[model samples]
Target: MFVNFRRIRKCQCVQLITTCLVLSLMMVCWEQLDNSVVSHVKSYSYRYLVNRYTFINKSFTIPREEAQSFSNFLYLLDHPNKCKGQDVLLLLFVKTSPENTERRKAIRSTWGNETYIRNTLGVTVKVVFVLGAPMTKPEQLLWNKRAGLGLQGELLREDLLNGDLIQQDFVDSFHNLTLKLIMQFHWAHIRCPHADFIMTADDDIFVHMPNLVHYLQDMARKGVMDFWIGHVHRGAPPIRSKDSKYYVPFEMYQWSSYPDYTAGAGYVVSRDVADKIYQATLTLNASIYIDDVFMGICANAMGVSPQEHVYFSGEGKAPYHLCIYDQMMTSHGHIEDIYHLWKVATHPQVKQRTSGLAGRLYCTAVKLALLCQPYHFNTYPCKAAFL
Candidate 1:
């Protein structure tokens, strides 16, 4: 009887182990199938949305030797003396006016400055200002031609005054210019080429570069590349009417549903993703909405998904501390709210006071810097050079 009982117990144990093994294999297969389905759905959707658009033929191929040389140049830029092992984060600012330029400088100098951010986060950061064209012009060719020249030159030489270039009727016109500037920078990368991640931001927004680096590092570990990370707004209403600057006719974008896209005020795209977007935009007609919707929503139809995190603020009204505590990459602030942004970013009392009555002197200093001054003159046949 004891021998029979032992045999039965051994058999029961073996069966239990076999069942667990089979279940584990099945779970793995199920997970892979789920991922495959999601990927397939995304691929089909992109093809359906963008197959009919005029394709832009731009090659991102730098010769093997040239790529090595370019990589060396970037290495030097990141590690000047070979002592700092820190990676460089490029902050590309898209500015529209001298006023915007001043604001950008101030924000960088006060809170968004590379020095301050690097010291705090222990990483190297550099800011590149890509001055954008005025927002008033709807004509793509004219805007591109004029923007190819510096903003000040365009103003003085082309008789392009603010009133002539900007239509105050559209509140988001400035944001649209921001989109154009992002495209311009992406093209610049194709021309010049540098940096691991390209962070595009507006003059009026506040960004924490350290947080962004951490977020991106995590994403890299997850094997995520060729993707955009930011605050995503899905199913936003399309602009209507010919008279309105934000108007989008049914013919322009026939799709009723838009994929999740990032808020344009600030977002990071991998080098591969940036190249894809630049190519996609050349084939697609420019949209008239703000930067986020035009690029995030429209380009997303081509398989871009906005990465969600704790930091992207779409409301545009919350305090900087709230955003910072959330570990956000970018937060929006209007011209009038610049002081508040600065104060909250720098001051200790920021966490305490959300409102105030006292008037503080927020001077918008204007400085005129010459175009193509000291920097390498890009005379090469590149798309950004045309911009």
Candidate 2:
């Protein structure tokens, strides 16, 4: 072939420039790439292939003296008798903020209503709100003192009216979620130890009382122990970026992957597991602010593995359908529509639609279409359609 040296040189230059550009782009995007891909790979490898997390116990443990500083908050609002004298099946601790009165109200009227749960479901499910002190921004602290007082007074009145509030003295903020987690276990241990199961959930989460109660009743009948179930997050890597809210410092948790944990949006544990978690909190360094991840560490220390329940949502709302409602255990991120969703989800038609062979087949196909998607919806996994 007749070739021109000049054209060949031009092509070589173009190739060199393209390769250099690609290299530079990769270098620039390396951190993101690590966060999205490399970190997960490392996490999964550490979680599954290597398969040992015993070191987490020693690494995360602090002296009991040091641990007390995190959990030794005074209870500002408490009802010691809330679960007393009742044969409580489930002690639900809904983590809420001091200012979320409307959320509490909605929950009480809907899923968290002990009265409705007793009358309709014929179960003694005790629902209580866990919270810390109302805090204001540093700059506004002085001016907001009065506002804080008003909020406090309102919380007291609300608690008196509902008799379901459990408050502590620590400042209520995102970083204090671990404290709230500690509070739940600690309070449950002290006040409601007789309950068959304990559940920790967010205020925004909606629990299908009928489904959850039935599940717990079965587990109780089977005499289940060390039982923990939720939307399992297996081999989840920590976010290393400083800007991210979920970022874990290398000094705090140097591990590549966390111990398997359920989504903190909602999860359930048997009475024994709750005691194990309470003991874990007493020794483990509660510095990890992400409550769910901390729960994973605690559970890992106590040798309680989280079981995956496909119907338990992580961070997304379940699909709005009768098939979903029929089998749904929990759905996260509910706020304004909580009352409406509660009414619809608990309607008798949901059970009717999923009852017989024809209904079962119809729902199976409908769920397969809704749940088995190419992309994750964060509510239920694709395999949920089969169940």
Candidate 3:
């Protein structure tokens, strides 16, 4: 009996030691996690609270010649009262790379050929190529060498180089680019002075302009104009790695749930929302995420809700096969796929596919439409009766 009791006692002692060890290890881990959180928070707090507008005005200035030209253009374009209730403007911001020439050509061609639809739908779309510095005039000329394609629109050079935009010290540069684009839109409204809705998209995106118009028209009918619309994901963790360009230290955005932030590849904000964003910029300091997420968080702070829609894809995948049906917008595609996707989206026969044939056609048609389209920017008046 004594022997059994001694054995039981020894087992209890072992269990107690194991429990103590586990508790100690857990405490250490908790401390480490706490330290990490605190360190991250500290790193961002200073940067987050700094006023971006002050920095822009104080640290950065547009050159006199450029500033005067920009001001003159703005003076010519600004007409806030000109924005009518029915007009919609689409803005496509493209980051041109050498490998993307064919893709760019395809997009330009699609835009060129779709004039009839735009006129009918009462939509005006402009593509602005925001070229990186490494992309020279020679390279741009080479890409433009091809004829018979429809790559047209304004080419706006970014003030900062590729490296300059991404440098850690140039947080202000990021905000400046975004502000410049917004200012451009503001000027566009003044110039045309009648657009009701503005769509901002990336070069990689393929927009189903007609469908987008219909959707917005329906939304307008319902009297909804102050909201931001795009694809939204729940519980996206803030990027924290030092190596990543999208790193966000914890203090600036501590929450794991980004309330209804849109995937920036394609999104439409009403004119009121656009004005609100511009106004918000006056007070909000810029956070270092890609332009899309930054817009989301900024809109959130300004009381603009991002309504989630499935049409926008942040991941580089298409919603459907390119051959089967018309794609409204596909975010990331290889050079060939981008070209084929644009061709398929704009093809009349491709649009007529009613069922499973759409899927099968994508695979076969992809190889058939590999030719590059030429680029030119001209106002194509829509032949549609509404216009």
* lDDT, candidates in the order shown: 0.48, 0.91, 0.49
1-387 per-residue lDDT for model 3 (tens digits): 437888899999999999999999999999768766765564345335432323322322334454343223212111233234534454444444323455566666664233655666666554444332222244356655431123221211121211101111111233234444444444444543345566665556666656666777777778777767766644344666666666667666554434346765667777778777655544444434356665655576567777765445554444344332343433444345655655566566655563365544553454233211122111111110011
Q: In lDDT terms, which candidate is top?
A: 2
lDDT, candidate 2, at 48:
86
For 45-98, candidate 2 gives per-residue lDDT tens digits of 998888678888888888999988888889999989988898999999999998
RMSD of each: 21.0, 3.4, 13.6
Position 30, candidate 2: lDDT: 91
Ranking by TM-score: 2, 3, 1
TM-score of 1: 0.52
State model 2's lDDT.
Answer: 0.91
Q: Give the distance in Å from residue 157's predicted Cα in candidate 1 to where it truly belongs.
A: 16
Which candidate model has the greater lDDT, 2 or 3? 2
Worst 10 residues of 1 by lDDT: 359-368
TM-score of each: 0.52, 0.91, 0.54
Q: What is the per-residue lDDT of model 1 for residues 1-387, given as tens digits with 9 covering 90 to 100?
A: 437888898999999999999999999998767755664555456546554222211122334454232112111011122113446544344444533545654665654566676777665555544433343345655654434335445444322221112111121244346344444444445533444566666677766555566776676567667667666665544444456665657665554434456766677776667666665554443433455655653455456667654355453633333313223356666566666655555454433442233211110010012112344121111111112
The CA lDDT at 335 in model 3 is 48
Candidate 2, which segments miss by more than 4 Å at Cα? Answer: 1-31, 141-147
